[model samples]
Target: MDPADSHTDEIALSAEEFDAVRAALARVTSTGGGAQAHSLLAQWSALVDEVEEGYSWCAPELDNDLSCRNALAKVWPLLPSRVRAIRQPELDCIDVRYRRATIPWPDRPEEGARWWTWRVPRRLDVEAAERRDPDWPLGWEMMPFPRPASVEVVTWQYVPIRPSTKRM
Candidate 1:
């Protein structure tokens, strides 16, 4: 009996049937890799499409127009979280320089006593290099492109906030 026919009593394998089985296994592996690559490319393509669509309205001379800002904002939330992470540090560096430091509460004794001071950084520096490019989208400088694989997203959830009256 041929090796392929040894199990003929249970099942039979023809040349075409053997080839079909091989092809199915190959497809399964290919699909897995293909899906991942497709996902990554889709993300990249969407970002490029958004940038191109927003380009005409992004001239530096058009900075004062609200339409330019609104168009860019439409795509802002759809950006992948990863992209945002990559862009944040660069934005932070630029923001720190342009921000004006002011005491949050300078008057009203009670308000001043309870004031929770925090640095309110500028949204974006209009005078900066990135903002000066006419071809650049108005808020592109603040774009949150995710960092490379070195970074990961973390989430923390906790109970509701309740004010503590006890002074430490």
Candidate 2:
């Protein structure tokens, strides 16, 4: 048998395997899992870069590449609970309560203590109600127009996504 032909017999990963590797790497990378996880991710990234750039693979390099990917897959599941708990922030609509009242700060009555606070959604339609046209006098007024005495500006909150029920 030709020595060079042996290379062809080495296992090449299928597309599904590649996808699994990528998904695990992406999750660990996004969380900044830890020094060890970062190191393993870096190794996997380097392997991907080389593969993409058409680097010639020696037997040892191919073995190392496969090993690195497998190690990363294993490490991802074993990350510290706190690190695993980390997640990307998501946009969430919140309820804001504000009232027309004297400003608490001096010389800023117009900008006054209008003292506004936000709370989790009392219901999903809060955003729609806050954004709709004024109902007080039954007409829409453009900006710089007086807002009702007590009005809430529907806004968003940046919060870490929950593990379950991913959507708001």
Clashing pairs in 2: 103-112, 103-113
TM-scores of all predicted structures: 0.20, 0.28
Model 1, span 1-168: residue lDDT tens: 332222211224456644543443334434422222223323433433433233233223223332222322333344444433443343333223222221222232423221212211112223333343433224433323322232112223345699998999
- The count of backbone overlaps in candidate 1 is 8
For residue 158, give model 2's deviation from the true position in Å.
55
Model 1 spans > 4 angstroms off: 1-74, 101-168
Q: What residue pairs are clashing in model 1?
A: 82-146, 83-144, 83-145, 83-146, 84-144, 84-145, 84-146, 86-147
Off by over 4 Å in 2: 1-35, 85-168
lDDT of 1: 0.31
Top of the candidates by TM-score? 2
Model 1 residue 65 CA deviation in Å: 8.4
- As a whole number from 0 to 100, the lDDT of residue 138 in candidate 1 is 47
